[model samples]
Target: MPDQSPSSRRFRADSCFVTGGALLALLVVGGLFWAKYNMSTVKEWRGGNAWNLTYEAAAVSGDPRAAAVRYRHNPDSFRKDFRDERLGAIRLPWHTEANVNTGAVARMEVAPAGEGQVSCRILLDGVRVVAEGRSPAPGEPAVCEVTTSSTPEKWPTKPS
Candidate 1:
């Protein structure tokens, strides 16, 4: 108050910066902890939104299979951008412990003719199981077939 020199002013500025940086660090750490705990829990869609669904290699009468994916965003939002918009069903081949990400599609093989239609069971976080039943059928041919697909989209935020 009496006589504040240049060095004193510089020290005050540095202290403020240090305080701000510490607060920022604390906030970041707290956010990370919260996300880690919250994200670990499985998010089941009871009745609101549904994963994108589509049909692939299908036959009228034969073994049928299709790829399924759980898109983080809605299909209608970016229909033109993505080439394939089929997010059929969740599939988990192995009974191992594995967690599916926000936009992860579990591969499934359903035999509507032979194997009695493979069940679409996905192991969420290697602990939970999410099941959906649907088969791929062909239009022209009377026989069924199997189809494979790549991963689906996982947008941070679904288009509003």
Candidate 2:
């Protein structure tokens, strides 16, 4: 075998350095992707586990008998529209809206099950009904039983 010169050895060393650098970059990028996914796991779980509904505002028509409920997802733009430090402004995954008539009893029932479950219920009479839906697992939409007999004359058309 012939003796190798110094230049040949230097060339081999440079090739190893470049290859190592490329491998290091790949590892860093992969790690970042993994971390990002882990951090967003909560969001993904909530997205699939909350109840959502859209109903007419009771104040609009002042008719308690005219109410509807269903499952729906929270609006993506709601957080930006309102700011409340107490709620952590996290913009929950589900919510409800309804129109209530005068002299009506609006009641909400919520039972949540799972890790880190979030439960919320709200009632509004003769005006508006808004509620939050959050839980640890996917389930049925929270129920709000409204009770009112015969419409009242000159119903107050304001929600406070």
Candidate 3:
């Protein structure tokens, strides 16, 4: 058997080092990508859950107008009253129209074209009517606009 050369051993050690470094880098990159993907997915799920909570609250109350009123008056209070813990962090400007004829403080209109129908117009920032839904029958789903801005991202994570 021939004598093993020191230079050859050194060369093999260097190769091993380079290969190990490359694998570590690849693992770090893959971990970063996975973290980013998980964060985005969590954000999306929270957004959908927030909207669903709002709709569920309205449906349970059987009065979208009242729900809008509560939200418009005080978002924090509304969240507490409705037990919406997940969406309590979100904040948004809301406008509810008070009925003059019926002396009711609500944004929803019943019988806009006669009885047996209810319509609601929910505005954002007092300028844009973000949601408009009409129900011809009682206990029907109130269709409201779903926008990205309506999510928790609207509020800053930290207090300003």
Candidate 4:
């Protein structure tokens, strides 16, 4: 009922276009922010889901010998019936790491090749020590094992 001029109609159309553009831009920015937040959360979750199995051995004497290392890398490791792996004339003060499935049990046993000490440990996210064992005596075997939780909240953690 007011001024029905072409200029007035153009003004209304331009106002609508500007409002719509602003809304679209706001939506795009909001979506991007949401995606970025979720991506970081995903990365954090992935970081928390890791498990590591560690083996170590050392000797007082500089004798060259290979330790017979037996270990259960995972609960289902035997399903493949895979060939046994050898550390192959390991170096003194030797250590190794292996990835393990969450909530699975891991075990490691090492016989000292020659002289000093052998140790094995399990860690959650490489930060929390779940279990560890050291050689009982010189030239003896040591065993370490742990049962992990499927979720981080359920882990039984101790100082590393």
In TM-score terms, which candidate is top?
4
Q: Please provide, for model 1 over 1-160, each residue's C-alpha lDDT reduced to its tens digit, 9 standing for 90 to 100.
A: 5559999889999999999999999999999998666542323322122233322223233334333332222333223222222345333331222222234343434333343333344333333334344444332212211111222222233236
Better of 2 and 4 by TM-score: 4
Q: Model 2 clash tally?
A: 7
Q: Model 1: what TM-score?
A: 0.32
Clashes of each: 8, 7, 0, 0
Q: Estimate each model's TM-score.
A: 0.32, 0.28, 0.33, 0.52
TM-score ranking, high to low: 4, 3, 1, 2
Off by over 4 Å in 4: 1-53, 60-66, 74-89, 114-116, 124-128, 152-156
For model 3, the superposed segments whose C-alpha errors exceed 4 Å read 40-69, 72-81, 84-160
Worst 10 residues of 1 by lDDT: 139-148
Q: Tell me, what's the RMSD of every candidate?
A: 12.4, 19.0, 13.7, 6.1
Q: Write the per-residue lDDT of candidate 2 for residues 12-110, one digit (tens) a residue.
A: 889999999999999999989987666445443443222222322121111222122332222342221211111111223334453333233334433
lDDT measured at residue 61 in model 2 versus the true structure, 0 to 100: 17
Residue 69 CA displacement from its true place in model 1, Å: 20
- In the range 20-60, model 4's lDDT, one tens digit per residue, is 99999999999999976686456446553435556554454
Better of 3 and 4 by lDDT: 4
Candidate 2 C-alpha error for residue 3, in Å = 4.8
